[model samples]
Target: MYQAFYGLREMPFSLTPNTEFMVRLPGHQECLNLLLVALEQGEGFIKISGEVGTGKTLLCRALLNSLDAERFQLAYVPNPCLTPEGLRRAVARELRLVEADSLGEIALLEAINQKLIELAHAGRSCVLLIDEAQALPDDTLEALRLLTNLETERSKLLQVVLFGQPELDDVLGQERFRQLRQRITFSYRLKQLEGEQIERYLNHRLSVAGYNGPALFERAALRLLAQGTRGVPRLINIVAHKALMVGFGKGQRRIPRSFVQRALDDTEGVQGPANAQPRWPWGVAAGLVVALTLWQAPALLNWLQPWLPTVANAEQGGGDESGQ
Candidate 1:
């Protein structure tokens, strides 16, 4: 709805991962470069960790899209909340091996190994990318560790990249998966975007979506957004989206502080940090709310009077006369 007003060909703030709109912030670029180099070296058990809404999934998708097709064979499993058997089955399906159900556990592993060897012989490297891997059960993670055992004499046959929230780090720290944790050849932590990066990121998305207008976000509003969202990409998208809506509603061309404030008020769970100060005092705010309620009650009741039955109206009328 705000696209036309803002001159955007598409929704710039969409939550879905779009490689076309990927922004190369310094941290993100460095992480991407590291992952690319690590994958090229045929490393097994790579991991990328980030805070929630820090764009881990987006980075995963971008990596998948970034690789050259003939050189890299990629299979992506977005949600990895599965049992050991289920996780293996997902990997089997991703590799397009038939008879996955008929094969027993050992046989399934052998089949996947064979497929990886065949792909390697065909001059293609296989990569399995798992997102939201923090939810993987301990047993399932162990199973993944075993899968990494499939290797040629020189290097691994299959490479795996886990993209997940910070909880994945905690999960990896457990004693049971020490072997798997040790196998992580390449790891990167995605930091939240900085103020300047946030501006560049938003503008990059807008430009990718074919927006060619004046600056949409004012300097003050952008700073406010950066502070409010702590520079998390997804949160920045949400607040910016709502702020654009508010700007459109107010018939404004550029986002202002008021528009951003209204956007913050409308979004749930976008509350400021615990240490954040309220724009007004608690006592004054409470008093104003109570005063407004009391002041508007009579008008609200009067507006609803016509919808009430005659008896209800009569009761209201009697109450009013008695009060008078």
Candidate 2:
């Protein structure tokens, strides 16, 4: 709604995982690099974990887009909560092996293996990318492990990459999953952007969204934004988007600190400094106290006059030195 006011062609702070708006911060870039390298080496099992809203899905999409179709046969399973048999069918569908859908569980496995062999002979490597894999049933996970066992004389036939939240780590650490965990040759954890990186990320998204004006967000506002969202890209996008809308609503071009605060207050999981009670700075309060004391000093002395010597005694003392 505020795009035109800000001279932006599209929403810069959209939460959608648009590859065009992707900002390759250190962590994300490293994760992508590791994935590409591991896939190139035909690693059996690769895992990537991150907190919610940390861009695991974006990274998954980025990886999918990065791979060359000529060299890789990709199968993506976005939901992994299926039973072992169900998961096999999902994998079969992703691989476009329609015949596997008609077969029994054992027959399905054999069909998938044959398909992988055929792909391998054709100079294409088969890769299964599972997102939200933490929700996968234990039996389903074991099925995945077994899928990796389908191999030729030289190397494994199917390679798998799992993208999931941190709970995935806990699930994999269980004794029942030790075998599958052992097969993970490569792993990378996605992280939220650092303070400095947040600024760059914002600018990158704005530029990608076709914004060329001067910085839309004031520096202080941006700082609060980084603090509020704790550098999580999705949260930053949410808060920033609201701030822009606030600025637009006020017919202002630049997003100010107050606007950012408003945005933070409306967003969930954003604990900005503004949420706390306001307090005066110690230095400022001290200076104010000193100024007040000086201004009221005469009045304070007049108020204490009743406890001082009378005027008659004061005059006698004044004349004592002359002794007239």
Candidate 3:
């Protein structure tokens, strides 16, 4: 609603994992580089775990966009809350295997394997990118491990990349998943953006959305925003969007600290104690001043009593001279 008012061509803070607005902050860039390197090395299994709203989905999309279609055939399973059979079918659908729905489990596995072998022979690598992999049932996860077994004598026919929340790590840590966990040739844990990165992230997104005006967010406002959102990109975007709206409502072009606070207050799951450090040192200094004043009060009063008469006489002389 406030795009034109702010001189922005589009909404920059939308929650969608739009690769166009993808910011390669330190953590994300490292993860992306790791994925690319792992893929180049023909790693059989790769795992990336991040907290919710840490941009795992964005990273997944970015990875897909980065790979070459001619060299890499992508199978993306965005939702993995399915049974083993359903998971197999989803992979088949993504791979465009024929009659995947009509085949039984055994037949489906054979068909998927055949397709992978064909792709391998054609000098194309097939990568299965599974998002939200934390929701995959244990049996289904095991089934996926088995799927990676489809390989030729030289290299694996299929490579798997799992993108999920931290719960996925908990799931994989179990003894039952030991074999599968061992197969993870590359693993990366995505972290929230650091304090310095938040401003760059905001500006990058704004620029991508065609914003070219002066600084819309004040430095104090940006600092408060970083604290409020804990430097999570998604939360930052949410708070920033609402802050812009709040600024628009007030007909203000520049977003002040108060508007960002209002945005943080209005946002659910983000309305917590301020993440900024407490001013305990100031409190301690104040306490020391009070204690010193109280300790010296008696001596201070005694010292003032001797000077009181002289000060009164001088004041009287000055008054007498004025009277004359």
Better of 1 and 3 by TM-score: 1
Least accurate stretch of 10 residues (summed lDDT) in model 2?
278-287
Candidate 1, 74-158: lDDT as tens digits: 8888888888988888888988887987899999988888988999999889999999989888888898888889888988888
As for lDDT, the candidate ahead, 2 or 3, is: 3
Query: Backbone clash tally for model 2?
Result: 0
Ranking by TM-score: 1, 2, 3
Residue 40's lDDT in candidate 2: 96
- State the lDDT of candidate 3 residue by residue for 1-324, as single tens digits: 678878888999999999999998888999999999999889999999999899999999999999999999999999898898998999999899879999998999999999998999899999999999999999999989989999999999889999999999999999999999899989999998887799899999999999998888999999899888888888999888878876766667898887787777666566357523333433213333454457688887797898999999999999999999
- Model 3 residue 270 CA deviation in Å: 1.6
Q: Each candidate's lDDT (Cα)? A: 0.83, 0.86, 0.87
Model 3 residue runs over 4 Å out of place are 274-324
Candidate 2 lDDT over 1-324, as tens digits, reads 667777888988888888888889889999999999999998999999999899999999999999999999999999898998998898888888878778998899888888999999999999999999899988899888988999999988999999999999999999999999889999998888887799899889989888887888898998898888888889989888877776765667888888788777666787746645323333213333454457688987788788666876887888996796
